[model samples]
Target: MSEGAKLTVQELDKRFGDGDDAVQALAGTDFSIAENEFVTLVGTSGCGKSTLLSIVAGLEEPTDGSVLVEGHEVEGPGRDRGVVFQAYTLFPWLTARQNVEFALRDEGLTKSDVRQRADQHLRMVGLERFASARPNELSGGMRQRVAIARALSYRPLILLMDEPFGALDALTRQLMQELLTGIWEQHRLTVLFVTHDVEEAIYISDRVLVMTNRPGRIKAEVPVDLSRPRSPEMLSDATFLEPKAQVLEAIREESLEALE
Candidate 1:
């Protein structure tokens, strides 16, 4: 692990079932994410992208090897790591502000402190005005933002996102991506975002990890050299287009082999 690297995964492997029914979701996967850097894992379905994120989030233990956060092994879920899933996991009964406040309850914070902090995060995601709204009343994108605000309120060392924008429509997804990138830049968070969208990965990541078909392992690490504060316009720039093509080619080859 290098100095200032927020997270490290070494020879990580995950398996399910046993014997004839055994499945290897991840095999010999290794990577390091630096402090305050944004990285994305992109691959086809069943490539263990979510499984890998789960291991790093300590939601599931790897069958082999280790995951370390800030130099300490990730034993289980901790405040050091906050996770946002594709679904809006907020309590339906709780208002947006209250949902975010719930995450702070175990932190020994006062109600006033929680409210103040939660409001700050809600504002960060442009949802401050919707704080009193329930999940059922909000749009999909709004709910997702609430989920993110809840995660951010914890002030975790790393934000583990599993296709957080995957459920939204094209326009909403694009807007959410822009919102997320702005938040990431403002906070300098170490974000491990898992997405199947190649263009979204290219737009938001400092480096994109391409995973092989399951028994998943990193097949390539493509660094996004395009200068940031990235906009949709950059998608057409050669710097972005070139790497996007490379990733597409990698995915195409994998798809072809899978059919063989």
Candidate 2:
């Protein structure tokens, strides 16, 4: 692992079941994300991209090896790491602000302080006006905005996202990507994002790591040299195309192997 990395995965392995029925998800997966960096993981189906993110999030345990954040082993979920998934994961009964406040309940802040912080984060995501709207009353993109707001409300050291915008329509997906990138730029929070969309990965990442066929491990790392504050027009630019091509080729090779 790189010295002083904000997050590190070392020789990580994960398996399910036992004996002949066992399924191995990852093996010798090692990588590290530096402070304030945006790194994304991409791979073929069943390559354990999500599994690796879960382990980093401390939601799942690895069979061997370990995940470390700030040089400490991640034994379980902690407030220092916030997570968001594609499903929105919002409670239908609570208003958007309430959902965000829920994440801060264990922080020992007074109810009023929690409410103030929730509103602040909602405004950051352009959702302050919809603070009273529940999940069922909001659109898909709006619900995702709430999820992002909730995850960041407590100001985690690193954000882990699993295809957070995968469920949205194309236009909405693009908008969310822009919004998320803006947030990352403003906060410079370290992020570990997982996605199957090659363009999305290159567009948002400082570096993209491709995983091989399962039991998955890092096959290649493609650095994104595109200057930031990335814009929609850069999608067609040669710089973006270069890293996109690299990531695609790496994943294509793993995909072909999986089919064989």
Q: Best lDDT goes to which candidate?
A: 2
Q: All candidates' lDDT scores?
A: 0.92, 0.95
| Clashing pairs counted in every model | 0, 0
lDDT for 142 (candidate 2): 96
Q: Tens-digit lDDT track for model 2 on 1-260?
A: 69889999999999999999999999999999999999999999889999999999999999999998999999999988999999999989899999999999998999999999999999999999999999999999999999999999998999999999999999999999999999999989999999999999999999999999999999999999999898999999999999998888888887777778
Which prediction has the highest TM-score against the true structure? Answer: 2
lDDT of 2: 0.95
lDDT of 1 by residue, 13-89 (tens): 99999999999999999999998889999887899999999989888999999999988999998999999999889
Alpha-carbon shift of residue 125 in model 1 (angstroms): 0.6
Name the regions of candidate 1 deviating beyond 4 angstroms: none
RMSD of 2: 0.8
